[model samples]
Target chain A: MMRGESETYGSGMNEDKAQRLEAFEAEALGYADQLFRVALRLCRERGRAEDLVQETYLQAWRSFHRFELGTNLRAWLYRILFNVFNSGRRQEKLNLVPVEETISETIAWDPQTPQNIEDEDVLAALERVPRDYQIPVVLADVEDLSYREIADVLDVPIGTVMSRLHRGRKLLRSELTRYAQSAGYQT
Target chain B: MQVIDCRNYRELLDSYLSEELSVETNHAMLRHTEMCQGCRGEMAARRRLRAVLKRACSTDRLGAEAEQRLRDCLRRETAGGVAAIGWGRRLRRLFEVRGLFHLAAAVAVAAVITAGIGAWLYGAFDGPIARPDLALSPALFEQAAGDHEHCGLKFAVLSGPFEMPDSAVNYDPSYAGLEKVVAPAAAGLELRTVHLCGHKGRQFAHLVYAGEGSLISLLVTERDGKALDMDQIPTDDGIAAGMQTARRENLSIGAFQTTRHVVAVVSDLEAEKNRLMAERLATPLTEHLRRFEQQTAMLSRISFIGRR
Candidate 1:
């Protein structure tokens, strides 16, 4: 009787485990596209972006048992994404940024200039900013993650995240300005 | 409303543009913006840039194809292929697949061939016999090498013609009637053990010989699995022949096709010497194998009669 009861309990536990796995894919996989977009900006390369997103989801699935029931799931996803991204952080992140692209020489913001740069152009310009300043800018401005969230991803303080975001945006503006001038646009 | 100073307003610019600041801070920032022209202009430009970026990045995503790919990848991960298998067991399963088995077999064959070649190459060489379709079977060399390893190099020096062992009593079914064609070719070497090794339904004569400090072998078979990286050398005692030789690992192999069988001589002999020996044996081999095969049907008939 004891053995039969134990078997019944074991089967119940297995069914519960199966249900959790099913629930995870249904509920959590919605964030995968968002994670991938973030990964694309972070890596600045297509293949690496896919790899990063896959790794993030794979890790999230593996660590699903530790997750609290009802927290900020997106924020949690970002945390995990950043952790995975930074863990295997590339030494040379984006090779698109030219060597001469310091902020002082590139951007001279005038209110009179054309502010009609395309978003793809903006992204291209964004990729040209140095990696140190670029990531926080992407997180705060593009992905809409908070400065605190960026800090968790980057393993830096919130103050540092804000500073980097500001600097990164400034660099991006300058780069877009240079890109515009080169393309013979009035901006 | 309390107006914040420039330093504080500068820090709040990012928050304000992102619209994360509260109404109190927003009101203060507006008041401050009215006062500071430089900060206000910088903030305006940054706000425009941020809006453009936000709009763009919100829509920025993997394409439909990549999305499908990721969906498939996730599906595969969640699919019940082996949910209960632990990490260790899963990895073991990966290795147990047929592709990995083929890879292991190929690698083993390569290692054996490499060891055979290295053994010959490191010691000595002159050149190889330039021959067309002179393919050496690494598998055959490996078989002989295994048998040679089993019995060390203290083997009898072969001289004159040797007797063919009885097939039904001594050899495998696939190898029956094979000894008559093989013994004469092996008779000149410092013969060790005469073996009939069968692999994958193909039969071979694995004739081991004591070669220098290492044991060598002559594996003769009717089937030749075309070898790609065979070394070219002259194989002739005046029969139109081409010799392909190679050193794989510790053994040097010399191969040539006769009228009846594909003959491969693999040994610890120097590359040049191994090929020269194979070349010298070609005439005797061609003659003996042809003569033996001519009588093969008669012998089979006699053996059948004896069995009856």
Candidate 2:
């Protein structure tokens, strides 16, 4: 009698696992566009963005058993995408920040002018900000993660998240200002 | 309401926009904002920036065509086709076959040609060859021991012509076959089984021999892996020797002067074991070289001895 019960329990567990796999596959297909959007924002290329999303989905599918069904799947997928971006391609991580900040102590630049810039120009400028500043700004402004949630995702203190977000935005604004002045746009 | 500086207000703006501020803090921040024009302007600019960024980042604008293609590709990936394996994974799997024959076959028919050439060279050079002293001199050995806590030279000398391209010097798989022939002969020499990475990135079996400290490394690069027709000289103790070859069959040998040592890379010797064993068998090898030199000198009256 005990053996029979154990066999039935094992079969039930197998069925549950199969059902979960099917559900995860469905969710992955459904949210692929959103995941691809986040990856596209980070990578700025279509093929690479698709690869990043696919990698994220595959990882999510494998770990779906561990995912809490009630939690936000979008946030979970975003976290995976961010991790992929940070790990970067097999090649050297390209310094996303513009050449100026990277060589700053070596060279000085012209000061303060505010101007209106195009969205793409602003993004190209935002890329000039260091990743430490980039992460929070991208999360809070673009992905719309809360400051506390950003802290949770980044595994940093909320204070640190606030500081990064503030610094990130300021740098972004300065970059926009620089682009605008160069393009002959006035604030 | 407490008045906060622009810096502190700047920090709160992200939280406020995201609705992350606590009820009391939110209310206080709102009251402060109403009183502070500078903070209000900063907040407005930041909000505008955030809106622009959100709109810019949204890939919904990539539109239906791109989205459909991406979805179709993803659907194919999830449905389990060869596309899901990825290029890198597939390439790695291509080389991961366990058996030797399988790997050789997968590498191409060149293995068969390499085997044939190797067999022919073995047969041709199978004649009586003098053995050199296999171990380093006692003084040099002790010095090498002192400099290195753990050091050994793993060397293989090939007598046959190195094949070209895929079959050349370091790329030749049989180059390491000398180790099996020599290690047992050098028993009690304190040997270590080193991981044999292939020469020119081709895999080979390797070993290192150590007594106290000194190390000598012998590696072969497939001739095809690099441009050929160059000389190699190993110098250590006031003596140097070199070997060069242009054609597959012809090898040039010589003794050279150096500040420290005289080392020779034997290119035409069939057995690396014999080359190393030549030291222990020095009396016979010296006699042979002397006789050979005498005959050459008598024929042309040319000085055959290499000057120090």
Candidate 3:
């Protein structure tokens, strides 16, 4: 009804609106599977993830006035989902990292650091990474988001995102290597 | 091509492999990767890690239930005959007790105000009135009484047979009074309504105040005589004849005449209280009428010039 006055009150409004909405849905619906997947990972629960995804789509639709057509819809939706997750009052957990590496600037990563590994179990490894690190790494690798986009989505400094990505990959690799070994894979 | 050291290139290794760095930065990292095997190895490992994670994460899809719920949400938003906030529907939470209660209260208040204003405008005329010489005429009193009763019933029942046009709804409380003059100026009082009413080619400002379970109606109308005559009530400065108070069927009515108009208060309170309220209202309402007449004259002159 807010879209057009003629369509809202005129005789042919219903059929016209149905066609317009169908066109919009045709474009927005394909991203649902990906949106649910990311929200699921962010929330770590089924119920909350559904809510986050639903709100994200609804918000995207509401603010479609500002969205320029033919841009990266997936990234736009992800940004909205990330905002919902961060703004929602989730329980804070102190994910203890070694004091030396807690601050990104203070991290001392080796260029060719080695981990003892036979194979990789990336799914289990992804779950173990702290939320701060996991979000940037998953956005970067899984979603193919660039460093700046990851920073924008996570609402952190570019330098902090870079630090998280480096550390997150290292931690994920170590955990995956452990999972692989237990599963008797040699790599 | 610019040369780059291994340490800096290693820092930019991920961005370089992903081609996300700026062209200049990407060029520098490329030169380093081409020359240094160690940096190249770091880049390779990152690429492999990215590939594996992407594959594993891509496999994750929602079960049937979540998909259905999402579809239902979409259906409700897109085509359910509900007005969308923008292109999408509002995300109103289920079970908003406080919100619903506030909405109902707002509707009630709106109904009361509309009825009060409507009654003051049209419900107060008795046949065709004649120009009377008295400050407070019996005909005017009869009309005010009818208005009070009609508006009171409408307030109690929240529905009426009257219909108002869009132009008739132009009453804003802040602008209801003369400049810097408004209702309920006294303490422990609340304004019920203030409206412009008309009868027999004369207009009256009908201001109603309610507080302490008592209702007061102050009517200001044009005065045709210089002196107010009401049982020869004594006057302070010859304007507020506060000594004159009369009873009309368990209701106390009092009147005062200023330089240009007569203002009266009709209430259930004591005669002295009614006189005090009349005294408070009479002076300012007279001043407002004087200013309003001057502005109307000025506007007419301006429009006459434009037409010429």
Q: Flag clash pairs in model 3.
A: none
TM-score of 3: 0.47
- Candidate 3: tens digits of C-alpha lDDT, residues B1-308: 76678766766676676677788887788777788887776677667767767877787776678767765555444443322121011111111243665565465445434433443355332222121122334454554445455333222211111222111122211124432264335446545444444333333455566654677666655443212222221211224322234556666666654434456666777767666765565556555544554454455556545755
lDDT of 1 by residue, B189-255 (tens): 4544453433333445555555455556566665323222323111222124366666666766676
lDDT of 1 by residue, A1-187 (tens): 2223323323323444446555776778778778887787777787778767765665566567677869767778777777666544245333222233444442233222235678788778877887777767877887788777777766666766665666677678778888888888866
Error of 3 at A38 (Å): 1.5
lDDT of 2 at A40: 60
By TM-score, highest first, what's the ranking?
A: 3, 1, 2
Question: Model 3 Cα displacement at B292 (Å)?
Answer: 28
Give the distance in Å from residue B231's predicted Cα in candidate 3 to where it truly belongs.
54
Error of 2 at A143 (Å): 0.9
User: Model 1 segments beyond 4 Å from truth?
Assistant: A1-18, A89-114, A180-187, B4-11, B20-24, B34-44, B79-308
- Chain B TM, per prediction: 0.38, 0.25, 0.38
Q: Clashes per prediction?
A: 23, 34, 0
Stretches > 4 Å off in candidate 3: A1-13, A92-107, A111-120, A177-187, B63-65, B80-308
